[model samples]
Target: MDPVTCAGLRFAYGASPVVCEVDLTVRESEMFALLGTNGAGKTTVMELVLGHRRPSGGTVRLFGRDPFRDRRRLASEVGVVLQDSGCALDLTVAETIRLWLRLYRRGEVARAAAGLLADVDLEHRAALRVRQLSGGERRRLDLAVALCGRPRLLLLDEPTSGLDPQARERTWDLLRDRRREGTTIVFTTHYLEEAEQTADRIAIMDRGRVALTGPVDLAASFRRIIEERIG
Candidate 1:
């Protein structure tokens, strides 16, 4: 089954439509990228996928289950790296990861969290407090937490935001490794170059609807609309 499906998805806030009649599907183990400017509702769509917000119209199915009604089942299969790292500053890195791991059932908490930190190149910083971590390190920690549950579907919002070129490249490599291991990844990023290099398919959104979607080749079509910039 497809990892995610959005059929005729529609959302509104106080009678103002943010998204209208949007349709999307993501096959498992594929790299799917959602592209849009701020306020285009990319994050809104993700929230719906995560069951944080229910759709006002249409239907959303995750792994063939209704996200709202089968929330626990849905949560077990999906992991997320939100834009914000909500961990307390006083918490040590290991402590923060351990806390997140304990929320899952039958997981190798200590071993998995340690492996995840290594996977994201954060092993060296594992002893630091959340406050002592650099912004990039914090983001990596969030990614590690998302991986602890061994989810089939991973959702990342601006996964490489605020990182230097080297760190961003490292992140791209890590995501590719995960993809090879059969994990479906849906990511939202304004980083065109990163998407061009990392995504198997791209969906460009404007005004809360997909403007175009296809393989990386679609970038050529988008060039006329967007200026060329790497960051």
Candidate 2:
């Protein structure tokens, strides 16, 4: 079964529709990227997939189940890193990771926490509280928490936004590892090069609609589509 499917998906904020008739399908273990200019409803689509918001029209399905209705049952199989860090501010970095590990019922909390921190290069900041960490550090912590369950479906929103080049590359390598492990990843990124280099397929959204969906080889075509739509 496809990991994600959305048909004629629609949503709005107080009557101003943000996602209109968006249709998408992500094959299992595929690295899919969503690209768009600001206010193009990329994040809104992610929210619907994650079941954080109900679509006003159309349908969203994950593994052949309703995401919003089956959200709790599906939680264990999915990992998510949104733009916001939802970690408790008072918790230390290591403490936060350990907490998620326990919630996910992972064995050997100490070892798991150490490994997760290392994945995001947060080992050095293990003792720092969430509120004490810089924005980049916090984002890394969020990623670690998301990976706690060894999820099959990973959703990332602007995952590398605040990182330096080296850190960003590390994040990419980590994601590549996940893909190799048969994890299906869907992400939204403004960096077209990231999509070109990492994604197998991509969908470009414009004015709340998906203007194009094609293989990464279609990067040039994507540019032309956007130009024709917006110009």
* Candidate maximizing TM-score: 2
Task: Please give the RMSD to the true structure for each candidate, in Å.
Answer: 2.1, 1.5
lDDT of each: 0.83, 0.91
Q: Against the true structure, candidate 2 has what lDDT?
A: 0.91
- Across 1-231, the per-residue lDDT of candidate 2 in tens digits comes to 999999999999998999999999999999999988889899999999999999999999999889999999899999999878889999999999999999999999999999999999999999999999988788788889999999999999888888888888888899999999999999998777788889999998989999889899886566666556544
Cα deviation in Å at residue 154, candidate 1?
A: 0.5
Local accuracy of candidate 1 as per-residue lDDT tens digits, 98-170:
8878887637777877887888888788888999999988988888888877789999988888888998898
Off by over 4 Å in 1: 106-108, 226-231
Query: Which pairs clash in model 1?
Result: none
